[model samples]
Target chain A: MAEPHLIYFADPMCSWCYGFSPVIAEIRRAYGRALPIKLILGGLRPGTTEPMSQKARDELAGHWTHVQEATGLPFNRAAIDGEGFLYDTDPGARAVVRVRREDPELALTYLGRLQAAFYGEGLDITRPEILADLAAEFGIDREAFLADLDSRDLKQETWGDYGTSQRAGVTGFPTLVAGPNQDGAYGVVTRGFAPGDQVLAVLNQWIEGAVAQH
Target chain B: MTAARRLPLLAALSLSALLAACATTPPPKPLSQGRGAWSFAPANRSESAKLAYGIPNSDDVGLMLLCAQPRVKIWMSQPAAAPPKKIALRSGKAHGVYPLAPEGEALLQATMPAADPVLDAFAASGELIADQTRLDARAANERAAIRAFRGACPAKTR
Candidate 1:
């Protein structure tokens, strides 16, 4: 029998996903391969150019506050002052795609760090220089990361994932789907930021049920 | 095999346009409450809706609509006494939700034509990291605002 797989559908730019990061890490540690993990990009706001409107910004800020209070995550408001522009996630996501291509391990590490920068430190991920600086801090080859930042390959990959997110009916970030692969597989799907314990329990129950089915 | 195959790429794409309540109509009635005092109205064309009963004790308020698409929710809010956010009803599960900011309203109304597509795309990606940042930033900002509010309003608003 094949070991069940865990597919995590998320975008690097999702707020709830950031809140769930620690929980996801814990799940990976516990279930390493009894259920392997797969990361899918949910593509939050793919190609936006205009800065966020004050109305939109204020509303969203309210959401951020609500989520933080619920999840106990640290958030920095001052970060907004730095960019003073509508934040975009594409650049940050592209960097992740590029890194994942060369080294999935490094990509995972970088993603965690990137999340911290955006959510914890409130650093803007939209700017190339900001992304490049982050890469340098990780001891990543700066020139290479910059080059790949706009690489056709990574762009295609990001688009591909965006397309995939669309197909899955995954309209939000922090969506989790577990089941048999596209080939009539069975798994689980946890859509947004629920408590991590709830997520783990759901996964555990799903795995147990699937095991019993066999 | 490349793990990318397992990434559900196509799924993300198809769902992108349907993510936001930015350009659509309001859902139906028979409302119920949601997270943090928010309420979800009946399902409409293809989604549900949420309305906050004013923020905590302040006149600031919010309204959200979630499409039948299941997870997609759009919200709009105003500071107790602002114009009901002027949003054009566009095709697709798109609906724009904004707070009552004079500056935000000007841009939202002025650039509606150009801004829609961009806003739609961002809503589509729904990247986890981006969500995290926005949520955290909002929280941080909110905490500060609340602190200031307490200092200013103390007994009444606090």
Candidate 2:
């Protein structure tokens, strides 16, 4: 029997997913080897044309507040309040995809750095230059990363990841689904932000169930 | 106390009160509940819909529509309750109860018929009415969002 796969559908720009980062780290420590984890972008606010409205700004600030209260994750209010900040998340998602393709090992680390840069430090991650700078910080080749980011193929793959999120019936970020493979039957362990211990318990249950089925 | 000492103490209290007030303020309503615009990406034929919509700022709740064979599956951020087996969905004169099913712990779904009339009715309706929640998907971009969804996962020919 093949080992079950745990797919994490999230966006680097999602505040809730940022809050769930510590929990994800704990899950990684507990089940990293036992269950292979796949990270896919959920494509939040991708392809957005208009600048975010003032109302939208207020709404997101409230969410950041809630996430900070719930998860104790630091958030910079200035990021959302910054002028002309369009919340298009495609650039950040594409950067993660590029890193995943080039250096799969650094993909998750790259995602964390992007989240920290955006939510914690209030850095605008919608720009390719910003993403490349962060990539350089992670020791990834900056120019090659930019080339992959602008490639037609990467755009298609990132869009494909959005479609994957839709087909997986994922409505929110930080969704964790466990299954046999990309094509095989999968079950959602949790959706939205959850504590590490709670997610681990569900993972253990699913692992036990998979074993029993075998 | 000296006026200088009282000034600092008063400033501290006022600042604390202001922070508390900001924290206690109710969250803003989701953009979907109002006349907010939504954008749709170009559809991908290999999978389901390549669209995204949510109540802005309510990070935990979102609505996703996927095209499956013979039916369009709708998923919401809200969890499914055991009762309310059926939900009445209406747009304009076309109204029906989409059978609600539990997709996962944090998601609920209602599968609508994929026939043209059903899809057209939903597309043409100014608002999607279900109980007290009304989703305004009648805007030009919202309609495009729906079109992209249907285009991605069209019904298979028999």
Candidate 3:
């Protein structure tokens, strides 16, 4: 039987992906060695400086409240509005790239933490100090992490990943791709925030089909 | 011809079983059901007492969200909820009714979007699905927006 690889493409700043974290983790633990899991960064809103309009901000705040109602995640809009922080996600994306170089395993964890810190706790992740604070919270060596943040290598890697995802035509965050192993490569694309059951159902169907082909 | 002949029958059965398994289609999932901790009272003065979240409007057909926590109640007046639409929750993003209606997912998709604490309080006091968090936040955001909108639409208020 050919094993299937499941790839989750997402951004750390994405709120929906953050909500899907526990469910995905549960699925991974449940499926354990039966399937291989891969994480890809789908860069959302890269290189944008214009601050969100008040109307847009209010709409987002309401949306956050609704999300909290559904998922039980915290959201303190005061913190979001207190500081004059532009919702620039570039710094946070750069940080994720930095962590990928040092500890590839923890890249997704960093993404989750950053999402929670910004969306949940309303921290301004764009600021370097705040990013360092988040890194410290995760017990990562701040000095090493900071050095990576400054590295040209990390910056290039972030841009490179962004370009690849764009070329792949990933329009949004939290896209999951699962397909058959084509001689060591799995190519399946599951898009958007689908229900856990839906995701599992899709995988199961694909697996059965693959077995028939074999 | 006794035991040796039985092997072919067993192999036939195995192949049939595998083919059946391959042909089995998955069962459709049930619709996701759970009340959002928030809902809203109707905006029409005649139906204002009726609590709702996504309600239709007669005019320019925009989106509106009307919700009530336990203590507070408000409506997203500028953009209103249209029919064939319901506010729903997904991982983090709030997709409009069109994307969610067919899927029947949660209406409030925030990370802990509802005011469960307040809901619990009401529940303890013998309230049925009185979402306190939804009510409080809904009221707060609504009041603030109305104040701002009123200022912006001063001529229309009277």
Candidate 4:
């Protein structure tokens, strides 16, 4: 039988994706290698050189508050409150693509760190240097990582993931899909944010059901 | 049948089985995660003489430990749910499964003696997960709430 796997479509800059982090972590904690999760970065808001308007910043902050209230994850509202702040998501997405080439699973872990750096710590994750520093924490070569981060090919590949998300018809951040079952059918695990235990239960049930079928 | 004829037939059967084993739909589409987080308010208020502790992001505690004198009711509020018949809880090394019932949209409840060791294990454990819900039981305010609920509620029965 073909081995089963997970495809997680997310944007590192999305607040609800940050909220969904703990749930994915719980899945990793509970299942480890028994199930493998592949990360596909959805380009939430890419290639914007224009600074956010006051109204846009206000609207984004409001969404962050809702995410925080729902998931108990931290949010530094002031992260983008400063004047002339740009919210380009390209760098963060490229960084994950870069690291994914070296250590596929580490890509997911690095994505989590980038989310924490962006949302929880209020770090400007839109910068290549900042993204490189986060990668270095995982023992990646800082200079090599930065060089790759600046490459045109990685930029195209990151955008490719966005295309994949669109083709998959994912209209939201934090869309998790399960399957390629024996019938090769895929199932939506959760389109939006869900708590850790709930996700863990669903995963456990999937395993149990597969075993029952045998 | 002759050995050569039988050999060819066996080989054909094996190849077909191998092909079936590797068979998959040429292209797989996304299956949606059909469920979202359940609603909480109704579950929070389901019990009479109810006292609750916060579980993050929710002002309403759908998962409750209700005070009913000598027994504490472990009520999980699940609206329009196909919940497990028993709640499997884990907080660190301490774990147990308690039976459950559906009172309405929310599952009715499962009660244990107030002094049940599992309750202490649940309280002392770092994080509490009841069935599919993870609970924040580590906060000081919540701990105080637990103590207060226990004090005001003497278990009506063991």
Candidate 5:
């Protein structure tokens, strides 16, 4: 019998994932020791050149509204509607990867804080400088964070994270997959944003099943 | 400039601080609506399928389908009491009414045509909207989803 692991596929710019942050935190709290969890970046909008159009912004605002209504998460409408705001998510995704490499434990915290900084405070998370600042606020060294952010290798590594997510059959942000072990075949546990309790219930079942099988 | 004026000013400051604190705190647990729980089983070896069953943030009851194998299949769960008379899928240049079939207890599934042009169009689109009688839902991050589906299940060469 192999140890089962949980993988979470998410994007920082994804609003639903932002709503699921608190729930994910709770999962980590309860099961962090029992199950080794891996976080992979699902690139939502990478290499997007054009600035967000009004129609796109309006549609995204509607999504934010829905998430807020369902989860009570706060969102900054002004930042979303601000002029010249590009919706590219690659920079933020790459920042998470960088954090994951530097401090594995801080990676999730950085992701949560980044979500809060973007959706909650209306900060532009797509900019490398802004991301570096956020990293510093999370106790990461600012200069080193910037240097790593600009490294060609890190960019490729970020793309690699996206590739891993795609290979794992993750189509949406905040997807959770369960596997027999860290290196085994994975089955989708939950896709899209789910509440903490619902996720835990399903995970608990999986844990019990694994125990029974062994 | 008297004590009374100072008292009101201090009270206003305290209220502002309290509101700011409230704004920063994380939200409470969401009300239980029986949304967001799913189970998974391996698909047939020849064809790969990833099914997500639960209430998505947007719809009442939702199931997301990603299939790769003979061709590409992307299904967004719809709210139909009975199977709809017509089903249509439209993106940027890829627009067509697809043949619908029931998937399990709920969900109507459709496979995109295997032609290169159709697959290409679907892959390039930013969003895909599926429509049926009294139900409509859009899939975001569509390009990534299409790419993942294609990578996992490639079209078989005829």
Candidate 6:
């Protein structure tokens, strides 16, 4: 028999995942340690090389507007407007992986901060220094986080999460999966963004269903 | 193996490999209430029809179809951008080709006229393919929904 837990497949650079941050927080507040939620970076745009075309950047800005309207999340659309910016998601994902190495408990909290910094504040998370600055806020040594974020091994490990997400059939961001109960079966909580209330209702039912198995 | 037998054996192995590749492709998430089905949003007084191929009222959808009669538009979610800017649609004998444009980070889009035979094939055919990715194909009642939507909205007001 395996313990019931949640796995969140998300990317810090994904706008929808940024929108879903509050809902994940609600889940944590409600369930606490009873339902441990694991975070996995979905690598939405890892290692992107091309400088975004103006049209592409405009499209991204439109998406941020839609996200803001739907989730009431603040977004700095100018983030995509910078000159010749490479929208690579690898470095941001590595920061979370490095933090997870230090303390599993800090992963989710740190992820939320990164989302807020990127979408909310328009900080360039693709840069190591930006990632290091965020880590310092959590009392994580800035120098160590940069070293780990820059290390090839950490990049490989962070990418491993992307592979896990693909193997698990997660095609969209903010995908939440729960389970491996006594029968070793799992169920999807939400494959995309859901209202916090709807997510809580599902979580409540999952808890009931798991308890019923007892 | 003799040459005749070797040729047949090779063909068999290649066919199996193609089938396996298609089978290994991940399934697209359903847009409406039921998996393996398309859900149509209520068509207002207008002649345009908007249908979603993923979850209802959610931003994370697999496909979205917007039809206003002789013209039909499709927005598909893609995992990555392809180099080519055209979408080739295939369903059995029916084939449709359209210019493909990226709508956003994960969405690729194409437009076609309603009079196009490919639209009919999409409504009746049990399978669909766009570019290299396989879309949700089924014989569920949602096929009727798609037909109704196509009927109510023809690219030009009928």
- Give the alpha-carbon lDDT of every model: 0.51, 0.65, 0.49, 0.65, 0.62, 0.69
| Model 4 ranges off by over 4 Å | B1-158
What is candidate 1's lDDT per residue for A38-61, written digit by digit as tens? 676656655655667555666556
> Against the native chain B, what TM-score does each candidate's chain B reach?
0.21, 0.60, 0.19, 0.51, 0.47, 0.61
**Best lDDT among the predictions, by candidate number:** 6
Report model 6's chain A TM-score.
0.96
**TM-score of every candidate relative to the true structure:** 0.59, 0.60, 0.54, 0.59, 0.59, 0.72
Give Cα distance to truth, residue A103, candidate 1, Å. 2.5
The TM-score of chain B in candidate 6 is: 0.61
Docking class of 4: incorrect
Query: Comparing candidate 2 with candidate 6, which one achieves the higher DockQ?
Result: 6
Cα error, residue A130 of model 5, in Å, equals 1.7
Every candidate's fraction of true contacts kept comes to: 0.01, 0.05, 0.00, 0.08, 0.04, 0.04
Q: Which pairs of residues have clashing backbones in candidate 2? A: none
lDDT of 5 by residue, A46-68 (tens): 66556766755775676588889
Docking class of 3: incorrect
Please give the lDDT score at residue A2 for candidate 4.
46
Evaluated at residue B54, the lDDT of candidate 2 is 62
Residue-pair clashes per prediction, in order, are 71, 0, 42, 12, 0, 11
Between 3 and 4, whose DockQ is larger?
A: 4
The residue pairs that clash in candidate 5, if any, are: none
Of the two candidates 1 and 4, the one with more favorable lDDT, higher being better, is: 4
The candidates' DockQ values read 0.04, 0.04, 0.03, 0.04, 0.04, 0.05
Backbone clash total, candidate 4: 12
Q: After superposition, how far is residue A31 of candidate 6 from its true place, in Å?
A: 2.1
User: Residue B100 in model 3: shift from native, Å?
Assistant: 31
Overall local distance difference test of candidate 5: 0.62
